[model samples]
Target: MSETNSQQNINTAVTLLERYAEGKRNFSEANLGNADLQGVDLKGSDFSYADLNEANLNGANLRGCDLSFANLSQANLQDADLRGALLFSADLRQADLKGAKLEKADCDRSTHFPQDFDPAQVGLQIKDG
Candidate 1:
């Protein structure tokens, strides 16, 4: 998708999130590529199938969030909390996960980990790839 269209989708998503009253906000299938989402309280939100490639999520609170099938290639997730989050079939190729917490995050073989990360150091149990 073009950059302009992607930016518009991101703007719409942000507006929806801000106007959300109760219940978990569903941002599934939204194109949010290259958007800045730093320090947002997105806990328990549904981001399934969202295009978040190259987006910045530094220090974001994403605990218990559903990120299944999301395209997060090259995204910045530094210091983000992903405890108990679902990342099934998510694309994380080349994404920066420095100092991020991934405790109990459910990932499949298709999920890519950072090259610089040592599984033991981050307490991640690598399943079949």
Candidate 2:
């Protein structure tokens, strides 16, 4: 990515944090690709239709969040709390989910998980496509 593009991504991350801190949770259709957002608590937030490809969300709290149709490909979700989150049609291929809490989470058949990762193993509520 170009320097300007990288700077834009940084700015987006900062803005997102600020907005969340201000009691805002509707982040649908946000472009957060490659943005670093580790260790943030955003429970029950709305991130539907967002582009989070390659973003760093390690240890973030996303419980009960709506992530339907989001692009989380190659994202770092290590140790994140995603219990009861909605991930319909979300693309999680190649994403790191080590130690991530996914119990009670729900996903449609369109959701793409990492290789060898089973949603049923994690107690996810798998829905038919």
What candidate 2 gets wrong by more than 4 Å, as runs, is 1-11
Q: Write the per-residue lDDT of candidate 2 for residues 21-62, one digit (tens) a residue.
A: 888788887799998989989899888888899999999999
Question: What is candidate 2's TM-score against the reference?
Answer: 0.89
Per-candidate TM-score against the hidden true structure: 0.79, 0.89
Worst 10 residues of 1 by lDDT: 4-13
How well does candidate 2 score on lDDT at residue 21?
A: 88
Residue pairs clashing in model 2 are none
Error of 2 at 65 (Å): 0.7
lDDT of 1 by residue, 8-32 (tens): 3534436535634445367677787
Instruction: Give stretches of model 1 more than 4 Å off.
Output: 1-13, 19-24, 125-129
